[model samples]
Target: MRLDQMSGAKLEQDGSSWQAYAEQPLTFQFSFGDLQTNQDKIAVFVRSVENGQPEAWVQASDGEYQLTLAQPGHYTFEFKARDQAFNYSPVTAVDVTAIPVPAMISVPLLGEVEVRIFQLLVLFGSLAIFGFGYVSFEIVQHRRRIVAAVERGYNPYISGEPVRRVDMFFGRHDLLRRIVSTLHNNSIMIHGERRIGKTTLLYQLANALQEVEDEEFWFVSVYIDLEGTTEEEFFHLLMDEIAQTVRELPELAPEQIEILNGLLNLHLAENQYTDREFNRDLRQIIHILEEYGAVQHRGCQVRLILLMDEMDTLSRFNHLIQQQLRRIFMRDFAATLGAVVAGIEISKEWERVESPWFNLFNEIAMAPFSTDEAIQLLTEPVRGYYMFEPDALDFIVEHSDGRPYRLQQYALEAVNQMLHHKRRVITLADVLVAHELIQLSGQQPKGSWGEDAARGELGVPQTPAPAT
Candidate 1:
């Protein structure tokens, strides 16, 4: 008997069993050299003593052999080689064993129930269709409904339309570092010009916080436009979001959910809620989140991150709301959670409120993109959409001053105009034409127009560039 081209074989001394690590097919090479002279047959089978089970015997050719393990266990492989003359060799025993790993033994009853109710139902329903051979037909019908609903209800901003993030030359690393480190310190303020991508940065930061994964930290990102929102509406929106998130999470307990909902509603209903309601709610949310950090053996340390965008429009409470928020932010919940509040010149505007919390917040301003960053943003689009001349991007970047909002706006408009005109290349002339058309329509102001005045006329905030 000879073994040829043997690979991936594991051997251990002082043990009857040999081990190989695999969950799939197992193959090996074995040959009888003189078998060419006579007809022969060989049988291979794996017998398990612990289970007292034997696999179906497999026939082997003279040159090579293959076998597969259907289950994991300790087994002895037997080989019987017989020649055409009815000669047989003694049974050759090869021991095989599969290794196992430790797993969590306890399952919480509530979680088990949820899994059975949601996951098992969906899985078993799909399995039944598959078993009946109607899987493809059912999938087609279900997929059509999904596609139709998505087409009907699609809204870019609400749906989180994909925005290709461009790595700016003066990266946001320093600002991000300060914001993350401030998780230990308290709240931080993001005050900048309009369209400077404050909301974008906030979303990006939320993504970054996923790295922390420590249970102690919970990140709840809330974007309240404050447009057409009353104090009741705002409170309800916040509460609804928090409640739904808690309910959806499988890891949290029903008691914790009840505690959180009770605390939030208590503060809201008692009219004990003042401007300090935001502060008080924030404190409670953080406290509840901290409880998620503690397990029996290990305490997961995490930060509760609150990212709020468009702080200026939260004026439903009259001018008094702003003043109350400023005071509450300055005093009440300064030591608890990390917050990023975004608005245009908010710190300056809030200073009149005389709230020291306004003073305590670590203020960072976002500057407009540098010329290079603007050019990169412009050029990066060319590979995806080829309506523009290579030189057109440079021209757009020059005119836009590396402002992301304006860059995208101008680029999108320019491409539309070029396609409308049936032109092959978008030139500087095309951008100039679009500019004239946009200016003529009073969509954008002409030369020397005041940014704030233009923003007010357009009903859009002027976002500043991101600060390095």
Candidate 2:
């Protein structure tokens, strides 16, 4: 007979989902459906998909079976029948889902858990709030101090922007002194690396000459920045300035003013002169100024000191512009047309690609400050404020290595740190902190922090960042 005809197991009861407060048990029943032979055993096997195999299997015949699952989930029960001849009925599987016990539970004594959790949250939240407030208060106080410093004529250390006032400028007395004496003798060249205060010195020189213009007027200083101008623009602008200068100086003789007027009239007028015509007129105007620029300002004749700043900016143009400048500087402009030319690397042998007439200029190479000069620089402008610690001053001077711009940057940042920490006197520690902060913020591409510190880059530390 077929196995189905011999015997079979059945899932006749206990297969459904139910909610229970007490233990819920599952039961199964088997059937020997018209079997011709006797059956030895009947069994049930249970397995779960999510929860894996159930605890037990069973063997019985024509009897009820029960299973208690370990957890609430869906399960499958396989019911089978076996005969004494080792024949078995086919497995009949039925799925059942057990309903979980109600979610509500009660504990008689949780013992102040809610109160303790509230207390912990309050304590941490208070700390976080206090930390934020303290930092904010510190920042506000810092800003107020800086504002007060500014209000009281606190001269800040400036980088890149040249100091226009003589009172604000520092550490260039001797350089100015030499240039003062040299202006009457020959053409002047003020050259240094970028951001080295070349422009500021030129400004101060003009101020010096004007200040003494009453007693022994040597030259009326004329400053022109030739950055971002085309060759044609430079020539026209040069001539335009010459005309304006002649008109402004009442001390120049009528003949002297007329000479400049005749040559530069082509430019000041709407006359459409080509680049070559402008150059030709420029040469003539400058040649006349070379003869007559020496004027009676205070009994003695004064040369018009032509201060050309950022002259290297012109070298990127065509050779015609460069040649015009060379002729003007090398020949004559304003009698002893004193030329105080300032540009980056104009003194270096390698950067002389523009012209050989650089040799005509006596080099007044811009340099960093000495220790005494550096101290004066730090203290002189903002004298009445809190005294600087000698060690702090020494540290700044040493680290900055006398670079004017770097020195100012270091001092200003250190002062800022003093304000941040509510410090009365700037200390060496504050200096170090300021140095680190500024170094971390530096954006220069070509140099590293270590290299800058060694070379005296402004506001960079002589040491390293600290480890947490």
Candidate 3:
């Protein structure tokens, strides 16, 4: 029997044999032409052309045979018809060729172009995820390092208050020297805008005078904060500060202490102490010191320096009270008692030619720190432990405008940032972060008097209020 019909793959007659070809794995149905008696049973077999080994014949069902080719190859299919008596006809062969379709060309939902695009997307997506994870991990590690550094005391900058420690005090050397030299003969008025380190300078001056080894004069430096004092209580407060300071003098004899206490008790009243009483009490104290200096150290004259801070309060007093204060310094006490008074401005009243305070003091305007001084202030305290990058240092100096208080504030915040990141080096980025923090805390750096003066926001200059 010969094949009569075939389906699924294109079949063509090549000479006497039938041929078929398929792009994918080949499968087809075929039927043989035979008489009814011969067609009672049919069988089919398959074999590879390369191997030439035939498979056992299997009976076809219902006069039709189905064939499947799973691999790409040349194959032959043989069909036969068998009678009930068991006689079989000659084999009818068909040659078939199966060619595989490339996997990329036939992929579901992804053609050749789509498949390549998908592969690229996956590659780039994986890389982006890895990069993001790495950056996030580094940020976390940096934060941990900063926290650890801060706990270990990496920060050493001071802000918001006067520097009480002498070790942490920096710069102002020339200013200090000038003030000391001026105090030998004349009183000084240190005038500056707020937060310009007026009080800090006062503290330093106190320490410096206490350590003086002068041959001609013995210095008795008394610091008095004249904030919130009424005019009537001024003399009482002055005497009270003088008594406290003298009591702490290491060179004072027991009898000298007793003499001072006696004078204080006699002239410092519980209420209504007068300027006369203050003058009398100061005169006796100086005399006592002079006597002690003469006997103990051979003829050194004693001088008392009143380091009066927040002297702007004096401006609020009536002109009579102001004149009374000026007269005290202008009269008999001028030689033995000198004053280094720090204030915002010496009230416009003192600027008058006829005013008692006019020409009384050698005024020294307390300007902002010089660039060199600011550098010393910023770096000296944290020197050996942490450092600032050059750009960061410049940023602070430029932004702070050499104002000591602003410099400290900026440095303090920068250290805080360094501590947070556990970095030993302060960068410009760190200072910028510190600046934002300061502004967030409502302490924006307003620069110093020059800027303020330009804006007309600078009223008469004033010392910073005392730290609460």
Candidate 4:
């Protein structure tokens, strides 16, 4: 006998329900009749898409189930359901309307949490992009400005950049006066190490004597460097200077010009005519200068200041060559020309010539700037355009060994750090940073504190963030 079966289903909101149908395939077939309500509907039937053995028979049976309408769509449930006699139900179909309910989101906390997390990520991501762009722009602009300024040769430390003056002056009063008096009768040797500003000091001495109006001294200063110079080139350059000086002097008549000129060329030229010929030329140039002074006829003192920088270069030659050059200065040129020979402590070869008249030359040593001088060098003339804090000036001077090169290097680097780091008021910490960068780059910055001392000396204050 055929088992006649019926199945029903329902859905609840306020515990209300809707009834649905179950099917029996062994009996009559059911059709999807027209419904009246405007709601979504679904029909579920079980059928194995593949035909096989008993596994296919189980898959073809419609299983026992409940109606679970989640959304407004059609769904099909395919499974097996066995009856009491262990006979599986045949594939069946049922259709019902599911009244659409407003979706009440179940996870209120989780939904809100996801939205908040998304908002935070977007906010932080935007901030990161903006911050990176701003920093990059600043770096580019700063580099551009630095390149432009360097091209213009604008030094930030000192204001009023002057043209490269051949005659740069320094300050020394009584010492210059005594040097001038000595140079009038003697050729002095200026002794100093490199970068001690001896060349500048000599220029100042020359300027001082030149500025003396009431003194009847006609000062003619000639500066030369013997470094990389041959004896021929050395004397040749000196002759050019002396000839130009004689040509420009108003005290000497034009009629005397050729006599002096001829005399100079004769002595200044290659004297293959032997040592006697070379000495004759040297003595002729010296005699002409003395004659020019004597011809002034009004008791005029024609003083010639011959300033030789890097006199140590003469040592590169044989001792005899250096001795020959010294003979001219010690004997003949000593009477008419005031000579300032500048070199380091090792430049003794210039004075080692066997001439007792070397006693007439005074040896002046150039030392590094004093503390007060270094301070003045750092602060003055740069007061308005730039400034240093009270302790900042002292800190730089103390650490710079009173060396001008290092003083400027430290100050310029400190300024760079302050600008680069966007710090308004420069501190000792900035100095330390600049120092370390210079050291790491293999630059031995003067007065540089070691790492341990720097860490101990410049203790920066840490700022705490505000409590949220």
Considering every candidate listed, which one attains the maximal lDDT? Answer: 3
Which residue pairs in candidate 3 have backbone atoms (N, alpha carbon, C) closer than 3 angstroms, thus clashing?
A: 145-422, 146-421, 146-422, 344-461, 344-462, 344-463
When summed lDDT is taken over every stretch of 10 residues in candidate 1, the lowest stretch is 153-162
lDDT of each residue in 1-468, candidate 1, tens digit only: 444432342333337556654454456566552444443444332233435566665667555555555566776666556655546665565666744322223345543344445666669988997877786776776555434322232111111122323232123546666676666556777878776667777766665665444344444444334445565455555545555554554577667777776665555553444444555565666666667645421455444456766766563256565555555545564444456778786777656545434465677878877776766555543432244575777777777776666666566556545545555456777677766665576543222123234333322222322222
Alpha-carbon TM-score of each model against the true structure: 0.50, 0.54, 0.61, 0.51
Rank by lDDT, descending?
3, 2, 1, 4
Winner by TM-score: 3
Better of 1 and 4 by lDDT: 1
lDDT for predicted candidate 3 compared with the true structure:
0.71
**How displaced is residue 158 in candidate 2, in Å?**
2.7
lDDT per residue for candidate 2 within 1-468, as digits (tens), equals 112211112222353422222245555554554256643343333333434565454664355555555565666655656555556667665555555544433334643344556566679999999999999997887666545553332324545567776667778888898888877758888788877778888888888877654443456678888888666567677667656765676565677666666764454543354455565665665444445544433365656777888877765667765666666656644344668888885666424654655467788778777898888888765554455899999888888878776676676667666766655578898789767866887831111222232322222112211100
Q: 2 or 4: which has the higher TM-score?
A: 2
Each model's lDDT comes to: 0.54, 0.61, 0.71, 0.52
Model 2: lowest-lDDT 10 consecutive positions: 459-468
**Model 4, TM vs. native:** 0.51
